[model samples]
Target: MKAFAQVFACLFCIALAGVSVAQDAASSTLTDAEQAFVDQMTESVLVGQFSVDGRSDRAPKPERYSIQSVTKTSDDNWIVQARITYGKYDLPVPVPVQVIWAGDTPVLQVTDLKIPLMGEGFTARVMFYKDRYAGSWYHGKVGGHMWGSIERQSPDEGSKTPESESSESDE
Candidate 1:
């Protein structure tokens, strides 16, 4: 009886260990290098003095762009789920785009997009995918809604805090 119990306990522990490792890998935070890529692309999109720069103004300006969730769907890709509110109405729009690293720059390309660019009572679904290249990885100017795209990143990302945190305090 003691032997059997010991075996069962060992197996149970091993299973739990496996599960924990998987969760970590699945929800793995973006590496330092990856975050840098996201930052650069975002900077590129910021238009200064209506300069017609990358595409910030033309990108529909989703009200809130803080990434809500991220899941690793593959080795080279991540499924980035974000809730975007557009315009004064601040309507709830969920957009999931794919992000990957190309060379030193992290490329935020669109795997799929959905938007209604038509008349009232109109609905649109965009399965648009952007194939961009730049330096080492992506070319550039890949997928997006309205106009442009950048790999979204939360501010105060690199700190000694937990992963499931906003890194912001009530101000």
Candidate 2:
């Protein structure tokens, strides 16, 4: 697992570098709606709760993801800069995702992406519409459903400390 983590970290860094280059050469081909989606996601936070499968008796756990920015590189490619803080690790991750629209809604698609400190085999279909978000996630043997509201983050709130950050993306 440690070796896998190291390799994943290296790959993630390389992907981020490519994303940066792609962002620079990106054309202004985004539709009005896509631009709006990017604007809305800038400095936003998805504050909501998540449920663990087979744990119906337990209350849904709170989760918040702070998105510093979202940039479209191509027709369906986007990079979301998200600050992930777990335990003593706090790092800004440039998550490259594919965005498919459901009418005017944007759904972020991630498949088997390995994130540093978040483990491998992570798959999620998180959608954003209006000011709400809902998604299904699968990480290894644990899977869950998440839904929440999108809120603008204040300048002072760079990042909120999680109640209990988990290694899972559910955090």
Candidate 3:
């Protein structure tokens, strides 16, 4: 009976140690810079314009990305939960992107990512610096350049539609 008790206690201690290791890993996974980026992007809006490669005559269309959250899943992987409002479509998508750094700047890369209603073979390389982001995006044969400013949103403000966001951008 005493031997059995000792074995059970050892197993319990090992389980507790495993939980502690997991907690430590979870807490320390993201570096300070990465955590700051996550904080900056959560509940924020990217308001900007996108230009098609051959559509110079057409005015750049208004674009808005309402970020619900940005979470780092691994060293180079992040999931950006954002509501994309552009053209006539509004979609809330959890975008899995690869993050690579250039010095202190973090660039988000999406290669041939397909979202429902958006079609397939979508690729983009976007980088953030301070309060702005710029990138090139490709979908099928249509590709373009996109640039925009990031605006922090209050929790109660809620996400805006393209028309409403466009009006604000016009001002």
Candidate 4:
């Protein structure tokens, strides 16, 4: 049984590596327009950076629990730094996030259970322009199958998806 457990562990590790690679690839891809936006973002990063102010809710985010931090590491990868609030709570608590940038702007994939009623979830906003996705990152396993990463995104053409106010302008 010990050998069986060891083999299972090895298989799980290999599978995790595969998942990370796949996740990174999926997040980095972009549509022409999105790519344009990302390009602008990268340029802005070169110039310094912008900002993604505030925050909003994400619909049916792939995540299944409480959120930690939202980080945009690469043009394609975004990391959520936290552990699943319920289900099988892991030790050391890791940072879980939704990988974005591929075809869609990654949003908060989970809600904070600590919030009252609505959980006042992910009111945070992130605007990353340039970031180092290719580097050693914090990695851990969740649900015994999924993997998580913690990284940073450099901001460029800063944007806030959630706005506190709006102006009526004649078009």
RMSD of 2: 6.3
RMSD in Å for all candidates: 18.7, 6.3, 17.1, 17.7
lDDT of 1 by residue, 1-171 (tens): 222222211111111111223325754465766444333333121111111224454523211123334344455544433322222222222333345545454444432233332111111121212322221111123222222232434454322122123233212
Clashing pairs in 3: none
Candidate 4: Cα lDDT at 139: 14
Candidate 1 regions exceeding 4 Å error are 1-25, 28-64, 87-94, 115-171
Error of 1 at 162 (Å): 30
Model 2: residues with Cα > 4 Å off, grouped in runs: 1-27, 164-171
What TM-score does candidate 1 get on C-alpha atoms?
0.32
Q: How well does model 3 score by local distance difference test?
A: 0.61
Give the TM-score comparing model 3 with the true structure, all chains together.
Answer: 0.75
lDDT of 2 at 35: 72
Candidate 4 local lDDT, residue 95: 31
Question: What are the lDDT figures for the candidates, one per model?
Answer: 0.29, 0.65, 0.61, 0.26
Taking all chains together, each candidate's TM-score versus the true structure is 0.32, 0.79, 0.75, 0.21
For model 4, residues 46-134, the per-residue Cα lDDT tens digits are 11111111212311111112222333445534433322222122321223333344344432232231222212222222223333112
Q: Which stretches of candidate 4 lie over 4 Å from their true place?
A: 1-64, 85-92, 95-98, 101-171
Listed per model in order, the count of residue pairs whose N, CA or C atoms clash below 3 Å is: 10, 0, 0, 19
Candidate 4 local lDDT, residue 10 = 21
Better of 1 and 3 by TM-score: 3
Residue range 53-107, candidate 3, lDDT tens digits: 8888887765656676676666787676665544465545666767788988888
Candidate 1, which ten residues in sequence have the lowest lDDT sum?
43-52
Best prediction by TM-score: 2
